[model samples]
Target: MTVKTAEDRLHDVAIIGGGVVGCAMFRACVLAGARTVLLEKGGDLLEGASKANSAILHTGFDATPDTLEVTCMQRGYALYRDICENMNLSVMKTGAMVAAWSADDIACFPAIMDKAARNGVPVKQLDAQQARLREPALSKDVRGAVLVEEEHLIDPWSAPLAYARQAVENGGTHLCRARVESGVREGNVWRLDVAGKPAVRARVVINCAGNHGDLVEAIARPSPFTITPRKGQFVVFDKTASDLFRTIILPVPTALTKGVVVTRTVFGNVLVGPTAEPQTEREFPTVEHDALEKLREAAFRIIPALRDHDVTTAYAGLRPATQFSDYQIEALPTDGWITVGGIRSTGLTGALGIAEHVVGLYRAHFADPSPLANVVVPSMPNLVEERPRPWMQPERGPIVCHCERVTEHEIEAALTDRVLPAGTLGGLRRRTRCMMGRCQGFYCTRRVMELAQSHLPGLVSPTGKGRSDV
Candidate 1:
């Protein structure tokens, strides 16, 4: 596909950032029969925090009762469940358990249960024996746990891709590397000066820039809230260790943190850690050696068997923490803009609900409701054909990564996806797990880079310059 220029005319809505929240907002705008444009600073969609998340479909159990975040999470969970069923995306309904390790921790269960009930999440308190019966891998010292049956794991890669795919299918335009330098509101519309390109006009602008939310808000001048980057690092264990727990094991939350967790990813890997630490926006937010050690210690305390599992990978993600505890979703009626800020850790679970809410805000403020005709929900392409994975398809039968069983077909499909730019081996690895095996790209990095260079344009091949290093 050839690269296209930005549109000069005004759109119904222009969403800044191509992360999950932005993608969801774009889809919702399109579904409401509004012309929408999504601006992404990165080379492709999901290049930000959206792609590097814990990938849990939260049950609103941890959210404060009856708050906007909690309500949105619950609604978004249902919406995502429907979308997953319709799109054929990988979704695992593995329940989550909030384990207590001490008497004080055990005493907190009632309040947690009350919060869950207030949030409309069905949770049952289980004693250590019962908890062990449910998940035998849990440490015997577990005092008790609250079972959140509705909680599940989702494929992090597919969620944003599906949203972007559907948005494009619904005639929404997505522009990559089109960073919004600044914006000025003139009359009823906002004109955005996009990175050396022609200014694009829109009736409404929605800021869903994740970590860059504050930056984008500054461009609009006089921000309502500032965004802080809260970093969390995690480790992925080999799929052979997926049996470490039948359910997601979570530690009781403190005022500051949700603590460490051991959960099964939708991709079939067992994951642990995600220590929350505050960091500057300029930093890339990565795993610290000390943090990893602490995570391992906590993981072993929760489930001793995890210590025996071989780690496949380790990475970090930055959450866009804001001043407010609840979501800072508001419309700048005076500025003809809307800001979805302070999403934090629960953004993934609340994405769709937030999108829907943003759409209503547009209608209420702009007073222009287009015909809802031709409402279309795009079908997602099937990425996983079957289980025991290798024997599912001819391509899967050939192992590209000895540890992950990632196939050539999967990598090829991810590379060819128009919305994703798998130009580098690292990008491909993020998209398809091509080099995210136990060896951590030690064995297949060269081959993967070669394939990426051949498949993606403007990427440097291993043999050197094909396109300008510029």
Candidate 2:
């Protein structure tokens, strides 16, 4: 429960942004034996682009070969598997299938297979009959598919939370609502002006800002890339729809986007869509009714059985996409800054690997600190439906959210977490899966507010009577 303050001490590395990548960076830098600090602009971590995603742990089978993206993805995928069990994270190995519905899509199979082979990923060619045998719910019109064996699903929230928690437990500073407004380097040390806080001194600054990456990069030097936020909208069906499919259903790859995908989430619900539409808006990614309708139509076309199930909710996430197809990771030795940008859909899988690569960059260009001899590894609460939940145990407290079966004990634990407790309602939801089920927050908001009102700031109950609602 010890919280480190970034007061007068100079940090070896200061990471900007609190997205998944930033959390991973903080963990990497701290474990590398650096005095690290992470400054976030939001009320909680993952308030930006990392908050919403498909949660697919990609195998990089379709990534461009010999590229940084592929390398980072493969390494991240490996690192996640190595630490998942220790951190109590969950990985559902429900392999993916590139289902082809038309002759043109089937024609692209050879190139796809060649790319997978080049990337050293194992894939199988499944004929229509074979594909349907694996997933009987698949449409009979499916011509063929390429089965990607290593592609899987993961708890996107818990993975990053574990990373940040470990870093904080092992002597790292995590400051929320501390946005970096400007920076100036003097004698190999950078002095950063964080909004509403005293100046921070760091030997090196790493910008992991998701949507505001280019803007952060501009503070160091003229940014080489321009961030054009690409919006991806998705639909989540009720848990009953999870029975409609086993394998993740993917569409044929196009130049612009990955197209819509139909897959089951780790929380035992079916998911679909994520239409890649580019827009100028940076902060909020609003879900349009038309876009959501189109996504539902697309999902129905992919899995007709889904028509019988009700949709729980729909959401949209903004990706920090640049003009370049590959990741934009480079160390600016002269400016004492490093920029990690253009990480779009694969960020969840690439975050750990990206951390390793950035650590290498810091060692090669900046100071090479000794690695921590005793690294503290923290385990996260099991939010994955496949794992044992808190409510399943005998000593568990009363349930707060019946839809998700979230227990009062789990909510309290999340609210009082020592290293990084839930600072906002959204953070609490992500931490304990509370208010995220079919009923959303209708059944549990009052109880949750009662438990969290004192711990969280500016949190009021449904009764609009200030804090008296508690």
The numbered model that scores best in TM-score is 2
User: How close is every model to the real structure, measured as TM-score?
Assistant: 0.93, 0.97
Which candidate has the top score in lDDT? Answer: 2
Model 1 pairs whose backbones collide: none
TM-score of 1: 0.93
What RMSD does model 1 have? 2.8
The sequence of per-residue lDDT tens digits that candidate 1 reaches over residues 1-470 is: 95545568678789999888888888888878888899988777777777677888998887898688988888888899888877767777889999988999999999999988877779999999999999998888999999999888877766777787787877888887688998888888889999857888898899999888888888676777777788889988887887677799998998877888888776678789788887786337767788888877887888888888877778998888877788988887888888888888888889999998888898888756674666556555443423345435555545567656677666777788765446445456656766666788788766666667767667766677787331
> How accurate locally is residue 238 in candidate 1, as Cα lDDT from 0 to 100?
80
lDDT of 2 by residue, 120-236 (tens): 999999999999999988877899999998889999999998999999999999998888999899999999998899888999999999899999998899999999999999999
Per-candidate local distance difference test? 0.79, 0.92
